[model samples]
Target: MIINKFGFRSNVKSVSLSVMDCSAGMLSISLFKDLLKVHKNSVALVLSMEVVTPNGYNGKVKSMHMANILFRMGGAAILLSNRKQDKHKAKYKLQNLVRTRLGSDDQAYQSVHQQPDEAGKVGVSLSQELLHVAAKALRTNISELSPLVLPYSEQLQHGWSVIKQKIWFLAGQKGTYVPSFKKAFEHFCTHAGGKAVIDAIEDNLRLHKEDAEASRMTLYRFGKTSSSSLWYGLSYLEAKGRVKKGDRVWKIAFGSGFMCNSAVWKCITNLDPNLRNSWSDRIHLYPVEIPEVCDH
Candidate 1:
């Protein structure tokens, strides 16, 4: 419909995908790369939209109720091209992408699911095991992604730590080292799914509060915009003038079916500090104190 509305040629191609919410952005980039392989100099539009307002459920189920509190209606779009003329003006260059899925496991598969209730009214369900499943998915994704992004020194440290942790396990010990991804990427665009999600990522990665500021602020301002949440986080970094020329950025997201996807990008040039973005009007008020919310 977009292509038709734009009055594009009939030969222009389009594809729609629904990989849950979080990983859709990276998945769209992967799909665009595949299109480039088949059609040289191809231009692709990656669009992500989530309409959670209609999915809101008023039932008494607590887990299901959280979704209404977390998700919000939002969308984002990006244009990609292999054309020589467009390359000069591109903001960033894709470096690497890694995806992990644990759908084979029953718990992982149903961690975040949509189904009917006792009254046969359907709604999205959030399992108590959702966080556990997300952690597993992230570990699997990092295992595949670390080698592609982390420097050699960090990799050696990470490898030695894993071995030490295994040996410690045999000796009845219970601690493991967390390698610093900050050494690998200058900026991180973690999914702004919710406050809890942001907290978990920061804790697991041993990241400083400033490192997670963009994600936290994005969540506070935008709620959980589903797949587009990562973009908002990245936009936050840009708006703060944190991203620099030649800097590497790590974008990570989690979706239903226990999927974790990551994308690495290198900034092509230094971005203007005053770059207008979604948060232009209120960027000054952000990095604000986000107090803990306990529902007990």
Candidate 2:
């Protein structure tokens, strides 16, 4: 027990929490929500920051250089409370959270790894198998999450497809059906990992180009802000006046553990188009056409 500057004695809970590697933003929110459950009517603040120093990498490996090219300094702070009084002012409600990891597999664990080069200069080396590993992790996460967030009709269709796929496998054929996430979520905020990553998600999830516009714009404008990329994508939607009351959003992210994590949020208030935020000043210039390769 201790007394704070406010002169009130209370228990201060301190936790050294981390999910290991990136995606710490989502991990922090999960932990914060869990802590709130333990302390009723409590408010929790989750702060996530990433600072990429110029000296953090020293290598000529093309894979490693990709990190330096994409990673940048960024941070986000989110406040959450379970207090009934705060409900009226709350912007969204957390509906579901699902985390998946393949760290036990060697390929997954080494997908995004830090090590020394031949010159003994340390830098993060991305494995050539990263995309494959990431896809598996995302699939596993969606399998667990779909039941929780998707509509019953969608789930039934997906289940039937899986059964048909299994039968086809017995016949030495391949078939799969990708469930439509758009039916359940009005907005999709995926991590701005890279253009390839964003494109893969948009294609696999059957999302339209407009649905991935926020993520593509974030990657182009802010680079890869690591754990906070998802928030920036959400902010892009907010600034564009795309979010509305009763809208459901799907926030997804992938990280170093070869992990995929997702959270579902239901909007409680209609957002204002004129809302000032990180993207407000330049929202008009977004959804720009990014050529296959830019040389200018």
Candidate 3:
């Protein structure tokens, strides 16, 4: 049934995004962008999803337990068109995308990992140190992306701050301000990896409560949908009737390579509010407060 629904073709190259952390979704979108560039007149369907339960492992490993508690099942399919005519009917236009990978060291990779225990159940374990790694990567990614996205005033402040601190040695390596992605994009679909991650991003980016609400709501209601979490956030926006023609949307996701990936898209058409699978269906059941982490 699954095969039939997907309509497998002999010539299609099936790429599976497995074991990648939350950033996998942005990576998948970036891949779609590249494919569209190559197949300029063709249509491309991109699928992103993850199965967290299947990878759950039973062990005393505290790190793996974090994964067991964090991940949840979800998937998304996005259709892209490269034909110039598509501009008239398209729902969104592909804009700039940037991806940055840090922590290539073995220690960084091992900091977050999936391993099996005595019972032989495969599960993911994330070291507490992963937070530090994530922060470092975030800084690196924002540094590379900010100049491209930030306003000149903010960039100048960042530059002067670095110089004042006498950190000239790190001049090009510091990120003093988060890009005003919200200014450039009317909507944001940040990956709902966890409450802490979401909060950290919100604080770092100085996003308003409403700006982070969609991601937090999705995380609470659906848990971590891995690569598809951002779509769920987009669905939330659609449910609220916020997406409109010419509105730009930004998607940001983090993953295993200690990677940070971002995609910018401009909506071409107004989305119907009656769309099925909208996030509103489960919003009523979401906990008003973030739920306590379980040790399952």
Candidate 4:
């Protein structure tokens, strides 16, 4: 249909994927980078979408129940290319992408899975243990990501902080120091899955409220939006003009297969406020106080 509408040749090579729900979006971009790297000057179009139907679930399990409340309708198409000519119009350039999967572990793979119970009823059961699995994956991913994105000075400081914490640990001290990601990134587009997920990231990263305001506002306005929440948060920042040339934004997400995927992008040009986005009409209404519970 895209080719029919856009008048592209019918025989263009294309690939489609299904990579563990929320991870699908970032994984597609990861594949895009590899394709562009090998094919020289080629362009790749990555499309992500999720369809939620009530008929799919009839169980009252925690995960299945939450899914209806969290995930909303979303779809997005991203164009990526290695051609130098396309750089001028690009909003951001990919810097680093890290994908981690804990599928090897039974707990991780089973944390959020569709399974049948005693009466032959199937539902996606979410274990509280899911948080532990996700947090572990997050730490491993960030441990590798920090050095690539953090400035030299910040890296040195973080290293020394780690050394001190280790020394304190050996001295029977009950403490741990987590490096601040804000020192490395100007903006963060955390997956707007839920308030708890956002809060866990903020706490672990040692970020200030101003740093998390975009994510909080994104969650408030858009709910989960699945993997596309990253763009929603980015749009919130772009809508408020927080993103500018040379700024770095991090996109982080977690998926059902107990996957943690992250990508860092450097803004090449200022985001135009007038450019088309979902927040055009009510951006001013955002960065507002989002209550914990919605009362109907």
lDDT of each: 0.82, 0.83, 0.73, 0.79
Name every residue pair that clashes in candidate 2.
Answer: none
lDDT of 1 by residue, 1-296 (tens): 78867898888777778645677878889888777878887788888878776677877666667777777877888888888888778899889988888989999999899887787767788888988898888889988988887788888877776687678456554565567899988888888877778778888888888988888887787778889888888888998888999999888899987799989989998688787888899888778886667211
Tens-place lDDT per residue, model 4, 1-296, is 56767787667766767535778889888988887888997888877766666425666555566556556777777888899999998999999999888888999998888777656666567888987888998988888887888778877876776677678456564454566677778998887777788888888888788888887877777666677778778888888988999999999999877889999999998778887788889987877876659511
Clashes of 4: 0
**Candidate 1 residue pairs that clash:** none
Of candidate 2, the 10-residue stretch with the lowest lDDT total is: 1-10
Q: What is the TM-score of each candidate against the true structure?
A: 0.93, 0.90, 0.85, 0.90
What TM-score should be assigned to candidate 3? 0.85
Q: Tell me the tens digit of each residue's lDDT in model 3 across 132-249.
A: 7777766777777777766788788767776655766666664554446566667777767777787778877778888887788778777888889888888887877778888887
- Candidate 4 ranges beyond 4 A from true positions: 1-8, 60-63, 118-122, 164-170
lDDT score for candidate 1 against the true structure: 0.82
Candidate 4 TM-score, C-alpha based = 0.90
Model 2 RMSD in Å is 3.4
